[model samples]
Target: MSPVTYADIEAASQRLAGVANRTPVITSRTVNELTKAQVFFKCENFQRTGSFKFRGAYNALAQLSDRQKQQGVLTYSSGNHAQAIALSGKLLGIATTIVMPQDAPAVKLAATRGYGAQVILYDRATTTREKLAQQLASDRQLTIIPPYDHPQIIAGQGTAAKELLEEVPQLDLLLVCCGGGGLLSGCAIATKSQPNQTNSPSHHPRVIGVEPEQADDAKRSFYTKKLQTIHNPDTIADGARTPSLGKYTFPLVLHYVDDMLTVSEAAILRTMFFLWERLKIVVEPTGALAASALLEGLITIPDTKIGIIISGGNVDLQQISQLLK
Candidate 1:
């Protein structure tokens, strides 16, 4: 059984009732015509903090005990999760500290600080953020809210799929971007089972995780069935640059997800700009990972109802144009 269940996602939905944005489910005529399938884009790019990270961040912070809340929270992230924790902590009257890579997107670093969190920049080549965060957390007696490993975090991240399926229940395939597998693992639990007591395998959509070819840890781990790790990957998709899946997330993803696919850096950029031009929405490289899989023909599920989770919209304007060239 999955550590996070459909009921857990439903509870998260209740907790996020008015707190989180019910981001739109968008359909593009151009995309549909090109792909020859009905596609529903879960536009989490428009979500609070400009990413689906807010759903899990808020859920985890909100459930903290009184003592934990007062002690404050600490986390490490490449970008979106940092901003989400900062904003969520501010909203919930909790203090937050973030350990971010020095080279994280300028926009993300700015947004995280702008949300009122103390930011500590680190060199990924020299040291890991996890070690820094741990030392700080131990010193300050702060509660550690890791980016995607905790049960509440996974359950909260699952709400994105819960909302998507609530709007359109009969999808043939669901594609989610995988980093640490927080979003993908949480979503897979929700996608695999019904709300009721009985488990029906036939009705569930095949949940596939999409990762950058440069950082294909999750993809390699999926088929190997053993934990895999990658060193500092040089991909434009900074959000998907995690070394490997987490303890909680690895098991859930291995158990629930149907398959894993990888797309090229060029494909991600092509898809990101394509959406900006076509959908008129600003999507970051990580946000475009899953969409690029189908749009760029990395994988094909023809003539079916497909759901793609657009994970974030926090674009780095400074890098966007230069990356295309």
Candidate 2:
């Protein structure tokens, strides 16, 4: 498989221009004091459709051939990507079908349907979303737009990091929440490919991926130097509970990412609340994974300029109340 390159990311950025939200890079003095680092958060939580997935989904849909676009698109995702594809398809006047886990967050499910896509709910414990999506695509003649697997998707996701680096050119480290290595790999490619505007050759940031302890496939893959899988990890970070990394994303992660780290579920919940309480931002558990690792002192490096990608803000309010209770 051909690797996604900086040029691809640049093209994606151009495609996403004026469409995808260039989300803000947020900072808090309290968070900086706690981590002892100058923390800059690329807040994708505020992105269009309230997640970074819109960038990739819109870019992928925008690139489809006119015939394929007329035929429509199909994909499988837990939540954010589902809503992304649905909204993007709606914007492009194309039809979309999404295979989602039945147990996905209620808010996400509702938002996806609200975006006008046909929703197919499956048993995550018993059925594979990938196989189901493929079969449906074959039957319906719909183009398969995978959540994190395609080069177009990866390139589109890289735009978040590209935008961030363009804003904060002197970051020493960048931490990204990893789910099948899509966002992390994309960010790594974008950061490593571009020259920092700071004029310091050594100022290139070290990119690290953060995942849930229960869903640690990416971390295991990084350490073992091979692909790894975890079957239906029981974690609250539903977005990170992917079975494994994708073929295309795994290689980019291995080649460009510096390291992978895991944070405990407790830390994830704590950080979610912290972001809500302190940052005045509503970050979903999966989105908070990277920030959790940093807030909990999981990353050893300190007193450095760091960038953390807060992946999304979609959360079920009722579920949040239950979890808090």
Candidate 3:
């Protein structure tokens, strides 16, 4: 499939209309003082199902034909996407099955099951979720909806940027928390589509993808000029622990994304607390990644408006104390 375009995002907006929440754009006076730049946060943390994942999940599932939808759907996720798809499928009257790591956050696993999806847990270190998901799809003849890798999913995700840019037209840079590259890629396509907006001092937005230092597949892929996969990821940002870049998303990232960077786990935790104490947003480590990149100096833009995608809010309760401490 061709990389998602503005037209695709526009169509997705229609499909997702009244279904997806047009989440608020929040500005933090405290964060502005610290970053020394005006920051507009697109609060996907309050999105349906508590993350931006629902945008793509609903859009993708809505596009499936009646027969395919009846066959059900399967996907592999560490957490957010599992819940997103499960909930979306439930809303659409489709059966959903998710293969997740046994170590996935308890809250996420429970939420996925609560959405009526069959949750299959496997060893994160030993078993591959993709392999298991594929087997399940084959045995059950279910349609597979890959997290962050398909055109429909990417197009759906682009709607966030489309809405953000339309609302905050003066943004100079967009910092998106990267996991499997779907959201970032979608934002890139949306941002770059407006030729008058990119590179212009007033409206152009430099798109940057932020990943955890330990799980930097997009960073590696950007440097290698090929789709690179990380073997063993150990990061508090479980949403960003995808082992490899998807074929569909890799090319779009290579072409549209301006740069990719990594933020330390320490920085992520610090930013997570900062958001909670300051903005009063309960963001997960993965959701805090873009802010972490800015605070850690991994990404910088002087005297400009910056938009951050606060990706998700599904924090595991057990990690809450340590993350804040």
Candidate 4:
């Protein structure tokens, strides 16, 4: 696996400075009271395209040559990354084609089309989005922008942490949800670059990765000490349903991530509701995974400064009534 250096992440930060939203770090006295931790919520749900995927998408697109841009790009994503790549491709005057599961959230599918990308839906249970994406890339001669595997994408995603640490440098733990490990890998890069960003000389902020127990590939990977893959994982956190961690991202997470933990589907749903009611934030289940870990006491954040990434808000409203009930 190639090393995702701090320099690569810094370069990505500079490339994305103008394109990505430098979203504010929001804190609440209420959350502080509840967790007994200095809670800084980096609200990427408010980001353009409603997620941090835009930072990486734009960063990768920006690096493409004019000829390559004209040739267009392709990607496979469940939702947030699809919309991010589609929107960024449109903004950069590049055509995009996205492969998504037929059952992806309606809000996300619609948003991807709204960005003018041609969308192709496949079977959620059997059809392989990766194989489809590869075929399309080969047939169309399109540049494949992987959701979480590429160096530029990882670096772009890391910029969010770079900005967060810029605002709050004393974070003791950074909790992020892991799907394909893009965001966590990026966060590791960003936090590792700063002096004393960790609790001590040899440590950085404990970068804890949260995942639903049903689809906890990162957790399995961490424990088994191998790059693990899950076949056809079914989870309500659609955004967290990645089949495996990327080859490029696995080593980084293995090296930098302090720990991995799992939360139940009920915990995810409950936290989703909690954020909606108490925090007044419309966090999708995947976005709320880290908070779910906290709420369930899966990891102790007690009295330490904690950073939780509110990853995205692309929830299907049609399903809300059912989920709420």
CA RMSD per model (angstroms): 1.3, 1.4, 1.8, 1.6
Clashes per prediction?
0, 0, 1, 2
What is the C-alpha lDDT profile of model 1 across 132-178, one tens digit per residue?
99999999999999999888999999999988988988898999999
How well is each residue in 1-325 modelled by candidate 4, as lDDT tens digits? 4467778878888887667788878887877887888889999998999999999899999899998899999999988999999999988899999999888899999999999999999996788888999998999999999999999999889888888888988888888999999999999878866754554646567788899999988899999988888887878999889988988888889888889989999999999988888888888999999888887777765878899998988889887777767
lDDT of 3 by residue, 228-257 (tens): 888758999998998878888889999889
List the pairs of residues colliding in candidate 3.
197-204
- The candidate, 1 or 4, that scores higher on TM-score is 1
The count of residue-pair clashes in candidate 2 stands at 0
Compare the candidates by lDDT and give the number of the best one. Answer: 1
Model 3 ranges with Cα > 4 A deviation: 195-203, 322-325
For residues 90-179, could you state the per-residue lDDT of candidate 2 as single tens digits? 999999999999989999999999999999999987998889998999999999999998999999999999999999887889999998
In model 3, how many backbone clashes occur?
1
List the candidates' TM-scores in order. 0.97, 0.97, 0.95, 0.96
TM-score of 2: 0.97
Candidate 1 residues lying further than 4 Å off, grouped into runs, are 196-199
Segments of candidate 4 deviating more than 4 angstroms: 196-200
